[model samples]
Target: MLELRLAQGNLLKKVLEPIKDLVNDANFDCTPTCLSLQGHTPMAFVVLSLRAEGFEHYKCDRNISMGMNLTYMAKMLKCADNDDIITIKADDDESDKVHFVFENPNQSKISDLEMNLMDIDSERLGIPEGEHHATVRMPSAEFSRICKDLSSIGDTVEISVTEEGLKFSTTGEFASANIICKHNTKVEKAEEATIIEMNKAVSLPFALRYMNSFIKATPLSNTVTISLSSEFPLMVQYDIAEMGYIRFYLASKIEEAEYEQ
Candidate 1:
């Protein structure tokens, strides 16, 4: 048996929205302490890793893998409210369906949902940490808005990070626009403060659509983290309060010609 309940259903909503688009089917690796998912998008350009700790309440017979139909799960989560407590349960050996219960304490309302699970066979990437040319942390809303504004002008957005700050820009056939956010040294909430660490300056270009897709996680966390290096995939991570994190790895579009000054 596997059972978990979250204080807020929206946390699960924000976490699954961006991932469901990447793949129709996936697996949720459930343990006594954590539930995690790892898979690539259909196109295979972007990879995702999602982990949510046992918040509120958790119970598991043992370690097990529960296959998920992400599309069905996404649609089911639409019924959830930010304040509603969400609970999930399933018998690891009995049913092919996972059950959900949503409770709104203030409204004295409750709803139940269920979706049939699938047996998904997929490749999971090994995420190895290494030194990055630049690592920056800032308010997630700022990052989401930057991507939104630039995406209106072009399909691709370039991110340049240095000791000074971070820059976001886009270029079209006749126009180019840029925006920069400098690091903030002081802030009351350590989680919301902007911070930067750089070993060397680094710049890379990525699809604006993908960046925008990642913004959906803004509802899940207050701060966003970005890591970039020439030799590795671009990493964008968001911490979901007590629920762990949602991480994305995207390949940068590289051209030696574009690097020429």
Candidate 2:
């Protein structure tokens, strides 16, 4: 039996929050070193992949595949006791190694396990497969502010990018909002290109909802990455900690009469 006590609760929250929004019963195929979890939502599904070079006291390269129940993982992490020994059911087929047991109490921990994982559902995980016309990463806080600003004036937010800069605008039956990118607020980087290509504007409501979760993790960075295209999904990535990041993808929702007529 492998036994361990870890304290990195926030890390668990970061990993589960975005995934909960995508899948209901997530299967964590975990070994001692790597983890890969993926599920499908109606609109899109996200695959979380992670790796650790060395784990626990004894350094032994052991390959073990364990299918953990989400509900069990949820309850264990939700009301985690200080001495909770996370037990894993081993494969009867493989030989046991003394190094398979991981013991380290100095891990991480967090409060809201539910909040850590975003809205878990089937509908929100769908993503249309196609070649994206454009992609760019931006400051998540800046993008979140832009969404809130444009949302105050109207129900819809229109995002556009050009040679000049990126712009957020919204206009409905009566009100409207228009905001432009500034010199340092949002821009093109020397090492990386700024303002991902977009031939048209996407519906902002869903995009905002998706982004809200992206920045929920602690220790916010100075910037967030935003990638978009006319016919493909929009992707936002937040680098929260070392080797810990959250990537959110949202499909474009455009009314047929907007620009196709």
Candidate 3:
């Protein structure tokens, strides 16, 4: 048996919005201390971690993995109001369906939905720990806007980072553009500041489509952290207040000329 209650139901909604776009089905692995999901496509990989303490109520009889279609779950979540309290219940031993309950703050309204679970076979990928060449922390809204604007100009973006700052560059048939954000700690709010830590300079090209898809998580956090290294995939992370974080990883694109060599 397992159950979890979250006062801020919108967080789950926001988490699912981007995931459904990238992955169709996934397993939600729940343990006593945490609930995590990892899904990926050929172009991008995503990992979501939510700590059990973040929930108002959390219970688990044993570790279990519940497989379901993300799009279907997102649709059910859409019926809930932002202020609604959400409770999820599942039986590890007996049930093939997961139950979701939504209740208004006043307790004047309540709704329940159940969706069938699947037996999905998936293995969690182990992400190795390594230092990034450049780590940039900036406002989430700023990153979203940059991806959206760059997508309009080109399908790929060259991200370059130096001691000075971070730069996003793109080129189209008609024109090319570049946007640079400098490091600055002087801000009214820390979340609004652009901070960069660079161990070495690195420039890599990535698909803008995946970047835009990752931007759907902008609503979950005020600040976004981007880590880039020549040896690893680009990582964009959004930390959820005190709950946990969602991370998206995309591999850099190699030029045709480089491939020929």
Q: Relative to the true structure, how large is the alpha-carbon lDDT of every model?
A: 0.79, 0.49, 0.92
Where is model 3 more than 4 Å wrong at Cα?
A: 255-261
- What is the TM-score ranking, best to worst? 3, 1, 2
Candidate 1 lDDT over residue span 1-261, tens digit each:
888888877778878887776667788887776787887752223343333453777887798777888888888888877788999989856668888999996758999888888877775567756898999999998888888988888888889987668988899787889998888868778766778888899999888877887887788888999998988778888887755778887777674234442
- Badly placed stretches (over 4 Å) of model 2 are 1-7, 31-33, 54-75, 80-132, 148-156, 172-174, 183-207, 217-222, 255-261
TM-score between candidate 1 and the true structure: 0.88
All candidates: CA RMSD in angstroms? 3.6, 7.7, 2.0
Candidate 2 worst ten-residue window by lDDT: 95-104
Best by lDDT: 3
Tell me the TM-score of model 3: 0.96
Model 2, 1-261: lDDT tens digits are 322222343355446655665545755445465555656444444555555432222122455333444554555555655343232233334333211112235535433221122222332233466755444555555666777666566655566666555667777677777787633424355323244555444334344454444445323445666666766656666664454455666555463234344
Q: Name the better of 1 and 3 by lDDT.
A: 3
The 10-residue segment of model 3 with minimum total lDDT is 252-261
Q: Which of the two candidates, 1 or 3, achieves a greater TM-score against the reference?
A: 3
